[model samples]
Target: MDPKTALPLNTSRNMPILGLGTWQLKDDTAGTIAAALELGYRLIDTAVDYGTQPGIGEGIRRSGVERSDFYLVTKVEETDDAYEATRAYLGELGLDYADLMLIHRPPSSGPGEDLWRGLIKAKEDGLTRDIGVSNYSTDRIDRLIDATGEVPAVNQIEWSPFGYSDDMLRYGREKNMVIQAYSPLTRGKRLDDTTLGEIAGKHGKSPAQVLIRWNLQRGTAAVPKANQRAHLEENIDVFDFELSEDDMARLDGLNERFSSLGRLPYA
Candidate 1:
């Protein structure tokens, strides 16, 4: 797959198939983002909860890239007022509008019915161009649609070959929603798998590259976080080789429902 490929949203916009995720980035957030931008990364994924919005804004200023050229994604937590929180997030990012905003997770008390409304409101007010959800099960998403009469444009999830789910993939395809994959590298935990090693060796690629290629071939947007120059380069260098059907099948079978976040099944 081409590294420049973009996945269509339910809306008119298209999200870059690969993006830079800022979760634990701290003091180096601005430098890392600036470097990633220099490497031609056009999509940036962050959240108010990550406390990296300020750095992201600073990085964008330092990159000298045009705002319209790149995609910006941020999120509102389940506990916060989605609309107001979205406004605050924009203020932090020093942007007037975000390309996309997502509800960080399902609410503890409800199926995110109220939170969904807030996100929709933000979109209606032009605070965001598109809105979606993160860490939401299919059932919860259905309920949101039922309650708000709107389909989320994307669903961010903790997904990797080891944590694969056919049902989730099918759900995204059926809904015409992009599944933004976080931690596609397994956070450096499962890189030692013998099967993954074999596949990587056969293709003359690293295990991390193999994993990222798997996600890209499946059409899921993989946002692997990397602050170092080497990792930043390695993460986005998956466009050179293609994995065969057999290779994909082997990787798919590696799924043991593994999730570092202890996520439950997408019932």
Candidate 2:
């Protein structure tokens, strides 16, 4: 549960287990990111659809932290051309290279194999150091590997004590993929759960801290977003304590396959 803990990627890169998610931090995106960096967040997650890449890049520069010290993650939308989109993302961020790039989701009309190829090509061209996917089921990931003969380095999914599956965790381990958890706090939907509150009370930590610790304890990376300085500090402060096995089981029992993004069942 070390704050500086990083999981090894199949791509030979390491991703910090905890990061700042810039989903709705559209306004003052740069300022938010810069603040997160100052507060000790080494990983910053953004996406093409989030429309925060410009600010993200600017924030990184403003932080005065060398680009190599941070893990920068961005994604390509399903509608955009993967290769071209990767180029566009680099351009928008004004970065010569990205630490990681992901396919935001599968396109509605075409097979994702094409998009997977586009990501692979981006890696081949050195546009990004690592490549992965988001919102893709294990079967879809397998199909991409079968078609491209290349495995994804990570799978970004909506994972929390209430929404994740043991099967997905096993699948990720078997495939050597790092499962990055988005909405690890369940978007504040389950923060007030009695079980979570009890656990947080026991550790003298906030419910959000308990949830973030659960993600790390399960061996997945988490990206929790915060706009306020207090929240930014609170979110990354889960590294100091450990959740017991009994508490972990209690939290695991709360799972109902709930998706914060409204994608119930998450199949």
Candidate 3:
């Protein structure tokens, strides 16, 4: 698969099917990002809570890649003054606008109408090219659409064979929302699973590569985190092989609603 291959959005934007996730990457954020950029990563996922925005921006500059060559994503706090928070994060990123911005999670009360509205407002003002949500249930996603008269272009969630369900996958397909998979490697917890190991051996690939290929073959975007050059290369080297139908089915059977993030209210 092309490293830059992307899925179409409800808006006039397109998102790369693969991205580099920046959770807990603050210490060497700039160096890591700059290296990944050189390694052909176009989509870079970060959040305000990650506290790596400044380093990410510096990495983009340090890479000497044109701003237009990259697709940037960031998330906002649910309780944040959404629009203003997004704007401030943009300043921290040293970018005029983000390619995508998402509500980190649905707030505890109400339907998060205000948060959605603020994100929409940010998009309208060109603070972001697109707006979406993360860790949202199907009903919560519907509520946002019903309230805003606009469907999110992407719904990001913790997705892996172990953490995702077929129903959620189908729902995203029905809604035409690209389901961006985070923690697709399950934070290295499931890499040692027997099923993953068997499949990896057959493909002469690492379990991590097998997991990522599963996501790409399923048509959802994946953002796997890797800080070292070798790990980054290994993560992106998954495009060379295709998983068979039987392999896909075997992996799908591993779903157990498990999440490394613990029990999410929406999950």
What range of 10 consecutive residues in model 2 has the weakest lDDT sum?
A: 258-267
Instruction: Judge candidate 2 against the unseen true structure and give its global Cα lDDT, from 0 to 1.
Output: 0.88
TM-score against native, each model:
0.97, 0.97, 0.98
Worst 10-residue lDDT window for candidate 1 reads 258-267
Clashes of 1: 0
User: In model 2, what lDDT does residue 50 have?
Assistant: 80
Q: What would the per-residue lDDT of candidate 1 be over residues 156-186, giving only the tens digit for each residue?
A: 9999989967888999999998998888888
Candidate 2 backbone clash number: 0
Task: Please report the candidate that would top lDDT against the real structure.
Answer: 3
lDDT of 3 by residue, 24-44 (tens): 886699999999999999999
Error of 3 at 132 (Å): 0.4
Cα displacement (angstroms), candidate 1, residue 243, comes to 0.3
TM-score between model 3 and native: 0.98
